[model samples]
Target: SKFRQADFNLDPLWQIRFDRPLGYFAEILSTIGILGFLAYLILVLVALNKAMILKTEILIFPLLAMLIGQAYYYQNTTSSFIFWFWLAMIAGLCSKIKENKISFILNKETLRGRIMAFVGIIVISLISLFGIFFISRVCFADYFYKQSSKKSVGEEKIVLLKKAILINPYFSGYYITLSQAFLNNALSESQKPVKDNQKIFKLVVEATNSANKATQLSPNWVMTWQTLGMIYQEVLGLVVGVEDWGIKSFEKAIALEPTNPVFYSKLGKIYFAKHELDKAKEQFIKARALKPDFSELQFFMSLIKEEQGDIKGAIKSLERLQVFYPLDLDIIFQLGRLYFNQGETDKAIIQFQNVLEINPNHLDGLYSMALALEKKGDRAEALAYIKKALALSPENQILEKKFEDLKN
Candidate 1:
């Protein structure tokens, strides 16, 4: 992480989780610690030794070669499956090779040994039964969790999720989902014609509690903090101290994932909402450094420039972005509006035309095109463009007044 470059921490996900690492050895060292790695090596060595005892040692080279191939690049998924399958096959072959050497003769001399074997078998059987019971509980919890996902009705979904939590309360994912569910319910309750403040408060509280529980259960998991951050952010003004809570949540997420640009960007948004422009700009600058090429970051930077009354700076930032994302409708539209603001009507018309060329049916583009054309004294063309916009959005009061004004 110390030596991680521009997208340093993200490299692990792309290098290993999303793709393969330098080799299976590197992967093993990263995923499994030294103990598990040593166990894997021991298994291979014992298997190689058994192959020698069975006089089938020649087959070991191909198996080693297959593993070595994966060291650099995967041969295929089948080759990986074959590697483990071959290990099992070799172990079975060795077992059959030694089958006739030992006999279970229970005579007076071996009675004590046989009884000890029987006791060991009972212990193994009990362990297997316990494992089955544990697995069955997990299966039931997962089944309920999956059912909850397919449900559209909020109450049904909540019931299924609660049932899943009942079965496996330790799973952080269940609490995360429950937290989100409660948040969604709260939003829905607020939007109703007759809002129930008490119900909304209860839902919001439940959402926070569930999110907190998730963080407690899997304190190290980045998603838990992120989810908690979102839950707190949503109820910022509706509930007291949630602005501070949201800030704290995003701060925790940043501490855990310092290189991730998204947390910085979102934290900046919260600051922007609070009108702390300098704080917002600082966060955006950090995010831009981490991920300079992302269009969203550029948009944020341009927005900050606009908010700070550096209209020319905003336009300059957007012009550079235009070179990269020529088809981004919003960026193009914004550039045209900025040019129009500076009384560069001709440049604005060119951008509006570009927008219309890309999306002929765009209402905003059509309306903006009419205004730009009207500014240039092209009355007939402007009228025609406004008509097109009006036809698209007949219910818009602004369009109606503009059309009536043009007619007069």
Candidate 2:
């Protein structure tokens, strides 16, 4: 559940069909309903039918065998078509087995019988047309949603998402993506020098509403609740008691997927935000028990340890995680910070070296490298690193002060 969450680094449209079904009897039942399920069952019965009375009945086995293969490996359009086409073939064979007894009920021998048959045909035609209309609308909505994903960001993306929702408001994924887009806009607005309180407030409300809509649309989906919790958590101060709402959302997600390590880790982060360190640790421990090698969970555990002033313990956790996520910039940089905090200057410098090698432009890595270098009594090299850091963030007071100290 956790691993399937959308990657923020990629465009949302590119992530379409991540939630699509890979084929299952339940999927067919859900998509096509009871009638479809019965149709599939009819095929199974046909395949197993031992009665050799009708030679035409043998025609079904070939298609049934093909459908059996498709049902297991399906996610393809062609396979889906074959599934329904096979059902149609079965219906065709049934018609050849006998004449419709319903024709006798409306024999067309009199005016009343003729009128009844005419009405029946009209009703069936109308139903077929309506089914076509409803299905086409859904298909077009999905098409618009896919189109939205191709746009990088901004108004075009937002407009396309809104259009998709307008066409099919019942889809939870649309609401989730829309909520994320709104939150991104709100975050961008907050970072600007001149804050537009009214505009940002609107975006925040839209984000919260969209996330809430997603949960309503698919309450059982763990990812929807996780997305909702994230939205509420991000807008904590902007909306009153949002942190509590966030906790509830994550708790709901955890309830739905108790064994998922990431769910517990998310709930732990919410508790961590509320300064409930003990509760956070409890959640993290549960996560660890479920998945001992969960690197993300381990990373969060190290954070809790770091927050409690256990520098060595934090470093140990990150070091163990580094063995697995060798090139993880965040883990390497954090390990460097913890080593520096523990007064292990040389170790901190080496860790920083590793971080810089992976991500040379890492601002924190450069600044922390300078700090580690200065602590190791190499003011000259440290000053050079400090200047390098200052070039990146000239307005940063900490860097400016360090630069002046080195210059003077």
Candidate 3:
């Protein structure tokens, strides 16, 4: 009964024949278009029926094309399996078509006709072989490209991507992915001991070359420029003009996609690092206007407020953030510390207790709570809290000394 209903919509699943009026009309039009195409293909096959003895084999081409197109459009595993199964059927059908056609020509036609038919079969076979080879190469390249994403090791992913590039040299995405893998490897190598500066240099060079190749291949792609900019900014270190290159790249990305808050945020951070605080604040404000609820923007705003000697404004901003991310321990800890600095001991103690409730082993929370207790004239409770903190971090010389002093 459910299946029989007309407007029974199930999102991200099947849309059957009678789903909606528009869908019904769309299906009718598609069916008509397909049937018309098939009719035209049948007529073409019929015209070649005299020379081509295997009419069924000739007809199968359009059917296979239709099946493959449908499979690609639906993008489901079952449809893919059906497409492959039909592909297998085409192989057997091709052999049967060739054998039957040859036999028919030898039995019914003259020797000259038989010879011509054999020659035609050879030409067709060559074309079919070339088509199969090309399709197989493309399919294998796509498979390897997909595999590269699931791999964790950068070298292994690079190998897979290289294989894909060898098969599909024209695809810009393969080069881009390869570039990213090289950049990751370079960053990882940089963190290790400086025993091989040449090796790190080589990795960085490779990353730059691959990224340059990607940009050349797709000059208009915003993501390619963004990736190149990030590589220049982060991997190459902030050399004299490197930050300018990064800024220009982000500017290009923003020009192409003006409404994207992420691009604005990145540009703001670059300005922030350059200590151009006024320019940074303007970009940050624009980004905040685009994405009002962005937590990172709020955090950055609080930092800017603190930098400008507006401690109360900073505290108020963090308190507003607490309403959005109440359970975030980092925000709670920072808020508690801010309150403590402002001599709001009772509020600071409450926040410290909340932190300890969330994570009982938080050393900073315990130490701060002890200090708040001492300030409240509850020396016994202060000593108990300090003892707990000392037990947790027994190797801390400072905490051990504080514990001894409190015991006295």
- The TM-score leader among the candidates is 2
Cα-based lDDT for every prediction: 0.82, 0.78, 0.73
* Model 2 per-residue lDDT tens digits across residues 29-144: 76799999898787667643522234555555666576567567554655665656665655555554234866566778978889998999999899889977877778888999
Cα lDDT tens digits, model 3, 81-159, are: 5544554555455454456656656553687767877888999899889977877888899999999999975689999
Which of candidates 1 and 3 is the stronger one according to TM-score?
Answer: 1
Per-model TM-score, in order, reads 0.62, 0.73, 0.53
Model 2 pairs in collision: 13-149
Clashes of 2: 1
Candidate 2 TM-score to native: 0.73
How far is 247's C-alpha from truth in model 2 (Å)? 2.0
**Which of 2 and 3 is ahead in TM-score?**
2
lDDT of 3 at 361: 85
The lDDT leader among the candidates is 1
lDDT (Cα, tens digit) per residue for candidate 1, span 1-408: 213345553453522223346677667867798988888889888998898888775577877786677668634445666788788778877885233454544332598758877887899899889967877888899999999999864888999999999998999999999999999999887766457889999999999999999999988676788888888778766777676677788888888767777778888877876778899889988987887655777877797899889999999999999999999998999999999989999999999999999999888899999998888988788889989987776667898888887888
What's the distance in Å from true for residue 12, model 2? 25
lDDT of 1 at 201: 96
